[model samples]
Target chain A: MGKLKVLSVGALSTIQDEGRFGYRQFGIPQSGAMDISAMQNANHLVSNNPEWPVIETAIQGMKLEAIDETIISVTGAVVTLKINEHQVPMNASHQLQQGDILTISKPMGGVYFYLGIGGQLRANKDFGSYSTYIMAGFGGMEGRALKKGDILETQGGKPFKKHVIKQGTKPSMTETIRIMKGPEWKLLKDLPERTIFQVDPSSNRMGIRLIGDPLGIDGKEILSSAVIPGTIQLPPNGIPIVLMNDCQTTGGYPRIGKVVNEDMGRLSQLNPMHKLRLKIIPLEEALEKR
Target chain B: MNILKEKELPLLQFNKVSWDLFRLGEQSLLLQAPFDIPIEKIHDSAKLIKSVLGSLLTDIVPSYNSIALFHSFEESTIIEKLSTARGISQKKSTPIQKVEIPICYELGLDLEHVAEHSGISQDEVIDIHLNDTYRAILIGFTPGFIYMDGLDERLACPRKANPRKYLEFGSIGIGGEQTGIYSLASPGGWNIIGRTPLHLFDYKKQPPMSVEVGSEVSYVRITKQEFESWGS
Candidate 1:
């Protein structure tokens, strides 16, 4: 099997993986791959199953076509690749064939971007997650995002042996990032010495609202609980947000800081207004390299 | 119990009871109960801290006065089975569980804005929302939404100051004193009034959410032609 079709589905694209686990106690939204280390290094450069199911995309640009001889690759952000029309390489692994095509484009400093594709991109999983939780439509493909034409079958593989992602092992769009303390870091107070912040263009995949410097309150609201995906809440106009990968397994703002899962893949390749800083560190060096 | 700020914490001494944990990163953990237990013993201490962190758990979550968990503290016997995770249930049981929910009160599009803002009378706002029986305190903000807890403090309101860009996947609402069930519509602001044909979240079931945090839903009302021939 090996279909792929689409032809333009850019401004979004979906699929994702390494998410949806045990169902976040059912309020759902684990929805995976907001750069889970550039989709596990583009499924370790197409060897696949580093949590399989790739394609994410989103910073505009993704065109597809390849109906067979497959084996793709295109790791995270910093885009601009192509295929039938030429220009390739982004993170390595290629083969294309069948009707060829490919493309990618829009994504300068990052916004999701994985691709991967060696076998099984299949679709429709929902609770078990095929990712694509576009505001809870369901999970991948039919669950929204990946528009223009939408074909995407996959079970392809065959064209093998090729891997890349090497130079310093890629991961630098850093604006400083690190973080830790959350559990309402004793109500934040003057903490801004290195906090900078900014990133809010209404952010999505559930959270990431950041705006900077307001933080320092004793408003005392708490109550709501259990949040995830790199927490960092703080909202009461002190503006902080940050949760991601479809956030909302439960929350009530006021988390304070969390980010460190290796800077949540550079905070999922930032973008809006950009500029960051945080730093903080220490919850065991932010779980050091769990 | 009341452990706050905590430094290198993790040593609650379990069943000998001394809870209040924290350290929500690197495998997660949040537990909280320095006092006032009974929420069915905080869901029986979140299912006995997931059977004392069995197989180093993976998720427990149980909110409304806390539970959280999400394992893998690189297992050094998980802080010795989380200082004994309170023997799973020191008696005093009552985990709740009822659930019924059929609703549709003429599709309650806010039932006349909750009877002209609770001055009461859309049949007394469906008789004070069928005389209470709620309690599902927090299934979270979306995905089988839930959030319940009684609600009839004179049918309290306060949420839709402009929030309905859609609202229609099993609707059922109310805001302030809580009440829920949008399950998966997308945009919201609560106050919906009526609409439940079950499926609180069937992503092919198996705990695909159907009321949990402490269950006991209730509702029943039915009518828009039995909410269009509802089923399962």
Candidate 2:
């Protein structure tokens, strides 16, 4: 058994795995790590299963004190890591002794950082998942973000060989996101593929709201239909909102396109106000890319 | 002998009910039926797809005139399987399950607002709500939030200008032409009329929700005392 006491949580941090599945029919959002592959890679570095729950913290950073001997790995977002004031490289596994203190700095780029421990983190499971869905107040550390003085407990883990995922191999901040036409794509009057869109600061796990030149078409409300992560919804305001991991199961906005699944992890890492452009791809190319 | 056996079976109709299947990215498919089609038929098609796809599908969402199928399976495989399934007869005679929800009108946060909007007395509003039978059409927006149909045209009211940040579980509300109860405590924009004592959603239970699409719902008025003592 291992324990890590959170000294300070600088931003929104919660436990997340891949996500909760088979619950969208009930209108439950699939809340998970914003960058799924980064979370998986962090778990992989710690010798944990890719789907095991890990601590997902936003850009502001956090501090933790190891209460027991454990192995930990950090991934996602370009963040600075320090152990007892000594700088350490991220995307690498580090063995921590009892009472060791670890500090993670805010992302130099990107938005979320993941901390993976080499064991299962104890958390409440709702609808067969440990992922936190804050809107409904269920899952992970009593259904809320980690706070100061909170203790995270883990069970059954053995440190494997410490390794590092080479920089640039993993998902990084990207300004170009590939997309495919959605069900309501035909309703769009103009397709501004070359227009550079800026990520809105108000964006969160629920969605990445974008600000750019309006598509010059009124978004006619459609019958509330099925929506999934990566769906780009155009509301009456003409601005686009890219549905993220915590998006609702259904929406009434016109779905113009969906960010390709392959680019979702990279898209999640884009910092607020980061400029990006959408590239619409053919279905054949999308299927091939996947 | 095989030909004779094949001749004994009923001829399968081709394209009797068709939905336009479109791809939503690589992992999802959206099948949209015409809006003019009956919602029950859409529900039937959704059920048929679920029964056909079974474990291949990760999640299936049935909306007003569309069904979204989430899966990692090859899109062509799903489309082919659905095409074959559509030819099969899906007519079933299962009786509709009716749920009588006991509501306390005194708890209605916007009861007077709805009464003023409808130009009717509060008692008449309650009477109209209790007498009509509603059918759950689609469940979305929030977990276990069922959108029901069969609202009286007289009681139709636009959604509140500002949505409430929090609505208690089982709070019944009317929005535009739709009427339904908030199955879970959520932020909503509907004009609430009453509160039901029945728990519409319990996560610990096997199904979590007692009400589902196609279930019949009716309100039963109860006094404050009865509401307080419910399930005690």
List iRMS for all predictions.
Answer: 10.3, 8.9
lDDT digits (tens) for residues A4-49 of candidate 2: 9999887499999888888888889988888888899898988888
Candidate 2: fnat, from 0 to 1? 0.75
> What's the TM-score of every candidate structure?
0.36, 0.93
Query: Lowest-lDDT window of 10 residues in candidate 1 chain B?
Result: B1-10
Model 2 over residues B1-232: C-alpha lDDT tens digits? 0111111112322135767766666788888877887888777776777777889988889899888988868877877777777556446635777988899999999999999999999999999988899999898888888999999999999999899999999999999989888888889999999999888889888778898787898888899999999999
lDDT of each: 0.74, 0.85
The residue-by-residue lDDT of candidate 1 on B101-198, one tens digit each, is 87888877877887887787898878768877887766766777777778788877888888887787888888877777887776888788888877
What is the TM-score of chain A, computed separately for every candidate? 0.38, 0.95
Predicted complexes: DockQ each: 0.24, 0.41
CAPRI rating of model 2: acceptable
Where is the poorest 10-residue window by lDDT in model 1 chain A?
A165-174
For candidate 1, the docking band is acceptable
Global CA lDDT computed for model 2: 0.85
